[model samples]
Target: MSSALEVGDIFRRHGPAYVHAHDGHLGRVERRVMSAIELCRTAALGGHIEGCQACGTVRVAYNSCRNRHCPKCQGAAARDWLEARAGDLLPVPYFHVVFTLPAEIASIAFQNKTIVYAILFRTAAETLRLVAADPKHLGAGIGLIAVLHSWGQTLSYHPHLHCIVPGGGPSSDGTRWIACRPNFFLPFRVLSRLFRRLFLQALRTAFEAGQLQFFGDIAERADPQAFARLLTSAGRQDWVVYAKPPFGGPEQVLAYLSRYTHRVAIANSRLVSIADGKVTFRWRDYRHGRRPRAMTLEVGEFIRRFLLHTVPDGFHRIRHYGFLANGQRAARLAACRVMLAAQVPKAEGRAEPMAKVAPTPRPCPCCGRPMVTIAIWYHGQAPPGGPFWNDST
Candidate 1:
């Protein structure tokens, strides 16, 4: 793992050149993301020292950039987030549903990210709620944990929502729990049609209100008639909404969330090589029987593809709706636990009973005992009064 290829390596080597070549074209957020990834986990951020007591083996570990887009920083963040969500898990099975934007809308989204992305979230959640609440459907208010992913396997601009929804929800009258069919949650055609209608309607409204902007090849869409034609074309095509079978249980749900919630466009393990001014990485071709394949791109083009995924600053990609909404989560969860006759987990920040299982400690490198932090080293500072003062040491 220590010698593995990483996105940071590619960035550290050629990111400056990439930035210099496309200086004015890069957005502020994209530039920041590049800088953060290039400098992450190096002396730029500083880190701490860990020592094993028995063997007295000391090692220096650099601080992570903690930028959300940095692949290296997402592991710990994902673990911490999963810990907090562990208590929020219900006993029921969970379903994985996906809502994808049409290619025409995706082009518009590239320019109007904040507005269009927010609309994607709102409209997707609304579609689920509306469909589930009707008598012809589940007739229950569903809860969803929606995560926004804006890139495909090959790092293309493909905006979609991956929703983890419970298999059941509270009855409209709040008297009992309402469950969907054992195998099926909701009809996919129904979800797709409603989602298409809601999303297109909201998009048109945003265009009419002068909230969307078009540029480059899509600049012609700035005209009201052209934009209307785009929407009409999208409405006529079938939008895709996919529903997978429910997960085995809550544990499986957590496993799924841990992977999807904090993932970047690519991970270090996927990188195959970088040489001759080209970067190579592995990607799965889902349309072609999920065959694994390698792709190579010029250094500048690789950076350009990466920058395309830089989300708007301060925009949240993960959101909860219905019972999981922040305002009413606690009360609603309590009600849900009571209705299901399941035990409510203890509140967060409280020490668990000793009888419960505790997390395993990180093993030491030399002697296999638990490693402990002895000191911290900040950027631009040397070790305090030590002969081992070299930056590389």
Candidate 2:
């Protein structure tokens, strides 16, 4: 793994040139993402020294950038996030639902990410809540943990929300648990139609309120008539809202979240090669039966596509709604458990137990004995150079 080519490797080698080429077009967030990935786990971030007491051996461990967009930093972040969410899992089947933006609206969303993405989340959640609340449908209030993914397999901008919804919800009176039929959740046709209507309506409202911006190919959308026409065109097409089969259990849900929640546009493991001013990476072609395929893009284009996914600073890409909303999550979940007669988690009554961020025993590579921290260093400090360092230059 150490020898593998990473997004960081590409950034370290070509990031400066890419930034220079883009110049005025590159935003501050994108520039920071590139710099963080490039410098992650390198001496520029500083680190510490661990010495094995039994083997009398020492090693240098560099610090991670801990930037959310850095590929190298997501593993620990995902693990920690999953640990916290573990207790929230109910003993009920969970369904994976996806709400996708149509191409025309996605083009607009690309320019006004903050505004449009917020609308996507709100309207998607609202559609599900409204549909499920109808007595003709589920007739219950459900909870959703929605995660936003903005890139397709080949790194194109494709904004969509992946929602993990429990298969059941509390009855409107909070008197009983309501579960969906086995292996089924909501009707996809109903969800798609409602999602389309709500999203188009919200988009039009944003345009009228002067919250959305248009540029380049879509500059004409700045006109009210043109924006109205765009919304009309979008409303005519069916929005894509797919409900995948219910998860086998809560474990499958956790595994899925661990993989998707903190994912960047691409993973380091997917890079096949970076050579000759081009980068080759593996991608799954869902259109072709999910077949694995290799795509080669010019180094600059690869950088451009990666930067396309850096969301605006401080904008949340993951959100909770309905019963799972942070504001009322605990009380609502307790009520749900009582109605379902599910055993209450012990940790909930006391302090929430967190996964240990660092393992206590840092075993020596030469011998299976615990290592102790001997020294520490911060950025800009001159790290000791010798056999002790782990080549974190």
Candidate 3:
């Protein structure tokens, strides 16, 4: 078998194939991302070098690719995000909820990404909040962080939102923290039905405003009747709303949140091989027993699969609503901690100390010792001033 491919290597070898195959409007986004990834952290964006005092190693640390879709760039971001969110974790149990749209809607999303995605986030959150607020159910106004992922394990247009919701919410009067029963939360059937209705209604509004486009097999959605029929069919079909078992406590909740937030369509570790110039990787086929298997594709096809997931410009995939809304999170979290602490003997869950966030080192390929950052330029932003073309020094 040939060696496995890191993201950089795949970009170098097969990126052109992706760019060439994608020759239309959507293709432009893919091309831009590819260029950004290739030059990110390089002299192209302008960066400086650093030397390790101990090892006598000199390396050039370029600026990060920074494209949210880039695999190499999201790690440090995920960590920093979790840090600011540290105090938000309460001692209460938390649940992981996922709501997925069918392929029928996914086609519309492909054309109207930012609009449909925003609607998806809105409808999904509303469904959860509405269901949980009912006295017959959880009967509380919950806090949840929702992240939208637009691709399936195989890089298909399978838009879904992943949510980490606290098991309880504050009382309607905001006087005390209300907690859900230990073993149960909202009713999934109710959540699915409501989510389906809200999404279709929002989609219809988007269509009437002429905000949606149609081409290929899905082009007919531009027709009002066709759009209504599509929604009606989807209404009959099950809109999947799955909730994982309750976590042990808030610590487990943050650990879970750290996974979904800031993640792209796929991960580097999942790539297994680039043998004979063919890219091979693993994916979970959720339809058939959720079985795990490997897929091998020629370099061109491989990149096409990867490029299919490049999101629309300025789209915010991670969202917060209800009490977890950004403007109100701090006060709400503080209240949650205080309320939980009063009820449970140990309400302030012991959060794991955050690991240090350090600048990435570019080590010598000759010897894997860490390279140092001798100087920073933005003065604080990133490497500045592209390197000299010819410098032996």
Candidate 4:
């Protein structure tokens, strides 16, 4: 057994049996996720050789899978994403808002992930922008960075969107910036009501368009009447839209985004041990004051829960909307700065909070110097014979 336990370890050990057993249920995305995690950073994918610049040490470095769902690859991905987003930050308070799907809706969402998740993003962003633009509210065009999280602390399928929104934005005419009160952004009740209405309406549209599919227990939802009943039930309930306190500044916002943007279902550090066909891992019970606790699950169950969060290929989990929309983000942000009367930012100082954005390379074990890539190899090619280096830090 490896000294450090990883989700990949469980997958590599029992993935074959799990895959065979669940062959009827698993989709291509989940199967690919399992295979990628199992083979990540292994010579099976092929990598390159690296040598120390200071010392004459040589080592074999394997390639990373680079799959978004792979736990080992998110750290570097987060760093790169943060570096790009750093310049887009505005000089204002930022709020963290979460929009969650109710359990009833979440059940439907699980079956129609791509459509429902897209609805979640769209409705959540629309809710924020609509509410902010109301004259009764901030009455400004707001920008937000929305990230989709499909798992809870216990790796359960709990879908939610975490949105980092600037406290204010340019007015309708772009003449001046409209800033919200220092402590308040928008009314939660108004946002919740609108979000619920928008999502159920969108779900109905998708259903009518023959875009939603159902199977197994939910197969009956394929019936128009049955689906309408589900939506009606979901509509009656109050949706949850929570806004956290304002961030201190752009630095804190960058720090916060760095953590949530590229997160996977679970990190390898949470694993305690795997034995007796059971996997032990740490989690926080949020209901109980976030007290630390450990839960043990059968290895197969663990793998299933982890794989449940694999998103569809080519689907973006992180998105920008309103003023931050990728197409007009640069121009809109420039206008916002000018309206706010903030100093023009220099290239070097744009993302000072992310000064450490570059990931530190794994140092040579023998001399503690950064290893330099000496040679590269393609997949299915034989690598130079040497000790396989553990590139993880």
Candidate 5:
């Protein structure tokens, strides 16, 4: 199902004004995202004409912008990504863990995104590995897949890492599989304390090394005393480290991954309306039992919030750690299966065939005959044969 409301529609209507309003403030990446969303699946990009053989029906399918942040483009990308991960699943329960930064740190992260976000991933993964390997804990080497999300439901900057981990792992000596209690993964209090310490230490080191930048409200933190105060206050607060119950099985794990792995700040379906120059959209108020509510903001504000999540160019948001780390993923996974005495599961969903081979065209809606590409149109170019039927009709 598709929504009558789309992010592109919002962009098409108010984007230019928003751009003009923000002018010098918008970064290069934010401008690129806005441009991509506005032009996606439109004639601004090139497209082809598909004509039905039997009914002589023709339709113009515009090309996608393929921007990672675009809602329409993520569906295909998510499916493709999930298909690739299907083969990596093991016959073991998986746990969902989340590590979030406190508001102070989040403020700092907003200024130093690339460095701080990278540190968050590394420290979170390290905390998990360190805790899990202790004799008092699971005492094994675990595999993890972590994805970063930088926005809350209302598009606020809320940087966090979501980790999917198997319930058990190979022992320290590579001798046997060690599993956690059926109902428990790790003690959240322990995880929280260690994560807080490691993260703050890393932040202090970065600050001292002059690798982190302070801006706007946090600009005063450029002073060592002010920065120390910020760190001390954050260390006193309880960091959030949550661990959800283990998934029922591998299929459930895949289902959860499909939703989160490619999610943007907001999906188009959540958009309710645009009227009187104010855009209204649905958001979840988590503090209030997660009740659904509508929020209306001016066009510029909406675009501003959306741009808060445009990550630095070429920075990776999803990463693997420990046994799932890229260098030894295949070898470690094989060893894991051997420890569990389990057979390698056949690949579940096949990847799309190589793009070098053109796919069979879809049948026409009217005549049920295969449609052929009758013509190709580049950006700003009209159809070769002219309008087949009035699209507005």
Candidate 6:
């Protein structure tokens, strides 16, 4: 019925649209985020670009866009991010818990953004902590990390959190560490019910506190009665609470976390066909066999979908709580690492494995010594046709 869309057409139209729309409003905070995305790995960002002096193998000095949202820049970020976390991992089987918001709540989230999203994180974390503390499960305090992913494989807004936690936690007295059974984790049904109730309760609180702003299709819910109705409907629905089996060990958990943290909506290589102003890309249909599937959308529609993931200003998508709290974390982590290492057998000789760093390409226009990093370039300040993230004034 309508004309098809090409990937190129979509890119040509909306590729720079975000750049323009994001102007000045990004301000100081957003500029820092954009700088990490644009300046990463470009000569304009300035780096010690390596080049062979004799063979004329040249490399251009570059920087990296450290933006968590940039597809091209996330690999290195994940690697480095994992490295920092590796030291804190315990020598035990860790579980992966996924908490997903219902479609109705997701719709509301799209309208309110900052307020709803923050509540989503807090409520979910609270649910996990409360349920895990119950004597029926493992009556211990679990330390975990939660990362919020707001996009599905097709760049659609699907807000969810990926939580990696030790199967067991330390007891209330802090004397003996409790461990969950190797095979089974918490019951999903119980977790889901508790999660639903807690989330709704928190949502109602936010509404009364005037933290949530209703607009557009969601304006009807401004009335407390309407909002209560929406919550009731959502609460009855099966809120997704998926728990993955325990990982092999600490390294396995950290490796898995690397994939979810600092990821963009989609990778460039996954982009396949762009035809007639429509764009097609690969996606994994999780409802099925996790099979690879292709989806097509119009150029304008695609951009609209993509832009939905731009987070509210200064809101943290990745958060640590419980034992992972920022205050006294370093000291607590060091103590935990020491306690765990005492149980495991000592290493034979070599050091722990290192996460891989991305290879930075050097393009030497002037075949001389490796250019040293002098400065960095952010998005707005980038000169026309210059490095996207270079720090050229």
Ranked by lDDT, the better of candidates 1 and 6 is: 1
Cα-based RMSD of the predictions, in order? Answer: 4.2, 3.8, 4.4, 4.1, 3.8, 6.4
Candidate 6 deviant stretches above 4 angstroms: 1-13, 16-51, 334-343, 346-393
- Per-residue alpha-carbon lDDT of candidate 3 for residues 138-173, written as tens digits (9 for 90 to 100): 678897889888777877668888988878998788
The sequence of per-residue lDDT tens digits that candidate 5 reaches over residues 1-393 is 235888888889999988887798888998999999999998878899888756778888999999999989999898788877876777778899999999989989998899999999999999999999997989989989999999999888999999999888999999799998897888889999999999999999999999998888878999999999999999999999998778977888888999999999999999998888888999999999999998999877888898899889998888999888989798888798789876534353222222334567898999888988877988788657766545543
Task: Pick the TM-score winner.
Answer: 2
User: Candidate 2, residues 242-263: lDDT per residue as tens digits?
Assistant: 9877887777888899999999
TM-score each candidate: 0.91, 0.94, 0.86, 0.92, 0.93, 0.80
Pick out the ten consecutive residues of candidate 4 with the lowest summed lDDT: 346-355
Model 1 gets an lDDT of 0.86
From the highest TM-score down, the ranking of the candidates is 2, 5, 4, 1, 3, 6
Model 5 worst lDDT run, 10 consecutive residues: 348-357
The lDDT values for all models are 0.86, 0.87, 0.77, 0.88, 0.88, 0.71
lDDT of 5 at 381: 80
Q: Runs in model 2 with CA error above 4 Å?
A: 1-3, 344-358, 385-393
- The TM-score that candidate 4 achieves is 0.92
List model 1 lDDT by residue over 151-243, tens digit each: 999888899999999889889998788888887988999899999999999999999899999989899999999988988899899999998
lDDT of 6 by residue, 1-393 (tens): 223323223444555665576564334543454445444555555454344544444344455555666666778778777777776666777788999998889988887778888888888788888888999887977777888888888888999888887777667876667788877778889889998898899888988998888877789999999988998888779999998877877767766887788877776677776667677788999889899998988765666676677777778888887777778676765555554453455352211546656766443456644433333445345523323233332
